[model samples]
Target chain A: MPDKEKFFEQIVRENRDKLYRICRACLADPDDAKDLYQEVLVKVWLHLHTFRGEAKLSTWLYRIALNTAILYRKQQNKHTPLLPQHISELPDASAETAHKQEQEVLLQKLHYCISCLEKQDRLIISLVLEEVSYKEIAEVLGLTVSHVGVKINRVKQKLALLMEQQAGAEIELDKADKR
Target chain B: MNFEEIQKNWQTQQAPAAEAKAGGATAESDLLVRVKVLQRKVMRTNLLVAIVISLTAVAFVFILRPLLNPNTIWYDVGMGLTLGAAFALGLLHWFKSMPWKKQVNLSSKAYVEQVLKKLHYLNTANQRLTPFFMVAILAGINLIYFDIFWNENIKLRLVMHIMLNAFMISVGAISLYYSKRHNDQSYEPIIQELEELQQKLEEV
Candidate 1:
């Protein structure tokens, strides 16, 4: 119950989910997303001393997450899978409700498409998906607001095209199965 | 699905239900323990570096005092220069690491540049300081040979000198080759990746 631990706990409570989403959007593997999430938290804790309210806390958090994700190199042997190893894990689709299953599928496809984008674009669109404002995304990415808009448009268009291609492939597979 | 639908789905999905590790439950305790382990590893790396530096200083102290005729003033100066070069090599790490520590707070563009800067520093340090350090050490050893072999048979001195210099030069060359190879295998790809990220960041 020290001050730093308390502060870390509160920040994690508020932002861990969104941070994980950013990781999930950037990396296709669920395990890698969790690993990236832990890496981001470690960095967040390390840099907590530097936070001076210069930017919104979530913006700061997203900056850390995206930076880590951009440069994160996966170590296969050293990965200690993060805790709460439950079935609700996104890629492990054993026990979800119907709507949950559908959402998971869509999210997985979205992750695949996100992974296919360029690295910075992945971070940009991930922030966009998190409902971060264009101005804030601009600030986090060190770009002008108009630049953020332009990039977001290009990323969205690319994402839509990728998702459509994925849907087409899925439909083609279904037709082949029926045949 | 439309982009808005995809955005809604992203927002609606729960990120693998797990609470904050505050209640001291199994996962809560486990995660905190992992973080502690990671923090401990970082501490251990720092400790190891300090130990190596202290040991290097101790080794230089031993080298400066013994195995050469202390009566010769030039020999003493040669050893001093060698130790200075070694210390300089050690201090070069500070150049590579100071910016890395501050990069956690930077924006993405700045962070990418910081990473590239660190890697470029690595290659530059390897190219320049490795030769400088090895040559200083070799020069020191060669200079001390004058006093040590002053009374030895001339043939023995000449052959031994040639052999030692040849050995040292070969070792230095092999190390430089491997250092370059190491940089290429590791830091080069990272530099390329960062540069590409930087370009992507600026593409708009």
Candidate 2:
């Protein structure tokens, strides 16, 4: 086995990217996600020895990263004051352009869909988006391969339902705006 | 939306720079690196503990041994044995209770449950064992005082002290043996429970 410090450094260097992705997905804010990224790295460093190889390291890192981000966001929301609508408006007018609106709508739908998932379901979908394999997911989550497949299917179905609902709402909003 | 559309939409968006994955290694290498890092830290901690225990044992034998009253050998031996057993038991309990190498695949629910279990185990184990061992030491001391006051032949006293020391060693050894046994028995069950929890999440 490699010396502890060297081994931890190598792990940090290796997973720094994936950890960031996890933070980005969870936090949805660049600066907050960056803070989450560093926090996850520190935790991984501290708890590195606790990683038994029963699950893939990616799964473990994902778990830690997601949990940390969620906790941080929960804390932030409790303390931070919300901005007024005018003050919070985007500086880049391009961000509100018609082309960007469509993308934002989709992103908003995706976020709402994800949030509506059961916590476990949400985690699985997030990991799936990261392109984790069923076997690795199973290992990380201690699930059987077949079980992961079934659960993932359920999550997809739920997401599809959410997307459909969002689409219906968007149509209603457009009509209301015209009226 | 179709997979292609969804994929395309997602691909077009750029996550913030700090949250981006630029040039990263494969997942397999990442896993290997993490495991190696953690193993090294644990091994170092274990080594440090072993050294401390060795030094403490040496001090007990060389320094503390001669300072006790001549009549107190039995008391010392009994105390040592009881302490040794209790310490062994405590360590074993802690090792078993730790979530180290536990299935990291806990869905949020399972993770919370595991955390609760860990806390409960720590509390219950400490509550049950610590007091009992303290009582055991008190009993041992009482037994020694009775023997010394009631039957005071020097030769018999020596025999009693030797016997008490032997008894203490036996207790310590027994505690250590049971500690190992308890750990072995619990390992598979812990892994099995974790596996089941994972399956539940996967089926979600």
Candidate 3:
């Protein structure tokens, strides 16, 4: 393979998971997330030569991924269905061991809470959870670093409250089952 | 669970398998093809619209000659200006919409700067062409009226001429104002953002 192709493959391999996670966080539907992932990859490949070494490659990748994902969401919204689809049905848990199944359920709940967030806040918190630095996140999002810090704190608190409410609801259901 | 625990879980989730083969070479090419196809579609639509409008203007100038003296200077000038403006506007639209080759070899910052430059050029072109187009069409219409009405009953011709001029002027002014406002609203923010991005790239 040519040197350019090899370099491109290496980047993809290293950051595929990060890109996938960003897509999944931004899009509620699994299929839409996958489509967005592919779209981002194609864009990255097409624009790879333009990478100027100005921003870190990973930061550039995040910039592309987030922008593509956000645009995809906007396009989807214009054609939004009368009934919003359920957070894409999680993969069947029956195949997993009990502990793994529990983890999957928790992850699904987490994703549900994320889906409830206002669009920009969802992206901010998703990057926060992904361990992207405040400065890089601000750069990707075109916000001030200080603003990113404040927004992240607010989003985190919101998520905590959501999780608590979900947990409370689950316990109440358990009590009903016991009765 | 707390935010930290959620972050840990998020990190542990498996990434999906790579769906495209070999650095997405096929997918990238597919996208390029789609873009080309869309560009062609736009060009076709623009050409069709241009042809139709040009033909209509031409026909209007020729078919209306029985109402005006063909030998009159105003009639000739009016037809010439109307056709010229119509064709120029069509040509301008074509130039603006046609796809240029992508400058893939340039660095990202340079590429963005190039795009910004092109956008600025287009905006400038539209701004300059718009007034000329407005004036040309307005002159054409007024001249055509002058040819047909200049020899008619004096009082009736005067009333009709004044009314037509007032109506066209109001429409032209309103249109020019809105076109400028619309362009500023649509392109100014994008231009500002790109400039900021270019600056950030340079600083880095």
Best by TM-score: 3
Candidate 2: CAPRI quality band:
incorrect
Give the range where candidate 2 chain A is weakest over 10 consecutive residues by summed lDDT.
A79-88
Candidate 1 per-residue C-alpha lDDT over B76-95 given as tens digits, one digit per residue, 9 for 90 to 100: 67667766776676667555
Q: Which of candidates 1 and 2 is the stronger one according to TM-score?
A: 1
Candidate 1, position A154, lDDT: 94
- The DockQ score of candidate 3 comes to 0.12
Candidate 1 Cα errors over 4 Å, as ranges: A73-94, B20-204
* Candidate 2 chain B, run of 10 with poorest lDDT: B19-28
**Residue A20 displacement (Å), model 3:** 0.9
For B37-93, candidate 2 gives per-residue lDDT tens digits of 443444465456556656766765576556644364675665576457545654655
User: Which residue segments of model 3 deviate by more than 4 Å?
Assistant: A78-94, B19-204
In model 2, residue pairs whose N, Cα or C atoms come closer than 3 Å (at least 3 residues apart or on different chains), thus clashing, are A48-B38, A49-B38, A140-B105, A141-B105
**What are the per-residue Cα lDDT tens digits for candidate 3 across B52-97?**
9878876776776754446478887887887789788888878766
TM-score of chain A of each: 0.85, 0.68, 0.89
Each candidate's TM vs. the true structure? 0.51, 0.43, 0.54
